[model samples]
Target: MIELKALNKLHISSFYKWLNDSESIRYSLSAFQKTNSPDEVDVWFQSVLEDTKGLNLGIFLRDSEQLIGFTGICKISRLNKSGEYFIFIGDKSQWNKGIGCEVTRLVLKIAFCEKGLNRLMLTVSEPNIGGLKAYQKAGFTPEGKLRQACFRDGAYHDKIIMSILKNEYLKSVKA
Candidate 1:
């Protein structure tokens, strides 16, 4: 679980740890080479705080404010009423515990209800079968796969485009 708060400068160390984890980095699509200097993190935090188009939520453990993962909407277009998205559970040991699903569901509530966005869209690599199922359970319908969009681990993987409209999400929630 996570609480959306103002991005802080001190959180960089934890973010860096998350980014360094291979499992987490696999989902993040960000390149990190061993370390991110404090100055760089400071700048990054400043930008995240100044982010007006979308939101980044620092995921935490409810019992402890331990930063476990991150979930957010990007490419937020108020005029277009849409956004692209990503989620990362940094600690690989936590992957199969339903925490990722819980975090995603919470964010989706913010997207469709709080933000009043008409649609939410996300992409998952073809090999990420578990992620695909989780998104499906969250009411995202597969739009199709982009062939060879991701090149990682000496292989190419398709990216699956999935989206859930406000009406669709509402219906799923009700059902």
Candidate 2:
């Protein structure tokens, strides 16, 4: 139902709107700051394009080819063979469709099989129930929690640190 592609300038407008949408960023770090304008998004996009250690892709609907979200493995460490994974489905209409779990599996394949990475990690706010479930479905296990690490909706929430090792990912795919 969706495909991942390298984000281009054409996706800037949609990205700008998603970044500023309150509900879209409710459980993310984006909630803590403001995305003032499209220019700022353009700058951020440029940085993503330039980052050699990161891989950011736009999630597009297969039928309509609409840019609904983004996913990436960032802060990739060559020596350690690990990276931080993140995703956001900005289009609220697409929520709870199992897309998050599908995307997580795709990213896991890229990190462990394609990139030869040893591990992949991510953080999700405790209140993001869907995200927590999706990550678990993709074989990530909680490593720990950062108490009150995320503040949203007038309160603080724990941030769960989750990870999957390459060997674990390989075993998962075999089954």
Candidate 3:
């Protein structure tokens, strides 16, 4: 099983490694293009640890307590009651095992229930097939696309936008 916990010191290095991992970073909107320093990671952890509007949680295995990935919402707008969703499964070997789906569900519950946000959205790079599939399965529908929105590799790539509203998510969970 997976659990979402507060981002703590023990998980910092793993998250930093994930930031530097080329394959993982490729799909991220803010790709860690270069190797980030430990100090930089510490700064990031501190910021997320203090953010009131955002939910930055570490994804861990329940039994072994191993930190596998992280997910959260940032750019939170209390006035608008909306936020953007972001997640990464740091363990490459654990990919395609349905963990991402579970993580998505758990995050959605928090966003719509605990945070009381009206809308949650995410941007997926066009080439990120697995991440796109997981988000769709968790109830997000493609809202639109930004053509050549991001410059990655040697060329630009499209970013697909997906979202779910509070009413839509709540109704789906009731069924």
Candidate 4:
């Protein structure tokens, strides 16, 4: 099982490492193409901690209490009642284990139930098949695509936009 708690300084080092990891950051739209410096991670971490519009959580294993990755909603707009959702599983060993899907569900619950958001959305690169599959499994439907929006791996990739509204989420959880 997976649970999300407020991200703290204790998880900063692992978060830094994950941000710098080539394999992990490859799919992130906001991540720089190169490894980030420790100072950069510190600055970003502080911003995340201070940002009231965002909810940055550390993803942990329920039993072992191990920090594996980070997940949250950012660019939150209260007037719009919308936010962009994101997740990164830093523990590469834990990939392909359905952890992403479980975390997605947990985040959705927080967004709609706790935070009272109307819509949650995400963007995935075309090459990120695994991540795309996980989001789809979490009940996000593809809304649109940005052609050649992301440049990665020596080529440009399209960004697939997906979203789930509050009503859709309520219906899903009820079924």
**Cα lDDT tens digits for candidate 1, 34-146:** 33665665666678778887878777777778777667898888887888777877767677989878887887888889888888899998898899999998888999989
Highest-scoring model, lDDT: 4
lDDT of each: 0.77, 0.86, 0.85, 0.87
Residue pairs of candidate 1 with colliding backbone atoms: none
Model 3, poorest ten-residue lDDT window? 27-36
The candidate with the higher TM-score, 1 or 2, is 2
Task: Kindly list the per-residue Cα lDDT of model 4 for residues 1-175, writing each as its tens digit.
Answer: 8788887777788877787778878887475455499888888878878878789898999999899988899999999999999998988888888899899999999999999999999999989998888888788999999999998878988999999999999999999
Deviation in Å, model 1, residue 161 alpha carbon: 0.5
Model 4 segments beyond 4 Å from truth?
32-35
Q: Compared to the true structure, candidate 4 yields what TM-score?
A: 0.94
Put down candidate 2 lDDT per residue, 1-175, tens digits, no spaces.
8889998777777877778888888876552256647777777777877777798988989999999998989889999999999998989999989888888888888888889999999999999898898899899999999999877889988999999999899999999
Candidate 1 weakest ten by summed lDDT: 27-36
**Cα distance off (Å), candidate 1, residue 167:** 0.4
Among residues 3 or more apart in sequence or in different chains, the pairs in candidate 3 whose N, CA or C atoms overlap within 3 Å are none
What TM-score goes with each of the models? 0.88, 0.95, 0.92, 0.94
List clashing residue pairs in candidate 2. Answer: none
In angstroms, how far off is 164's CA in candidate 3?
A: 0.3
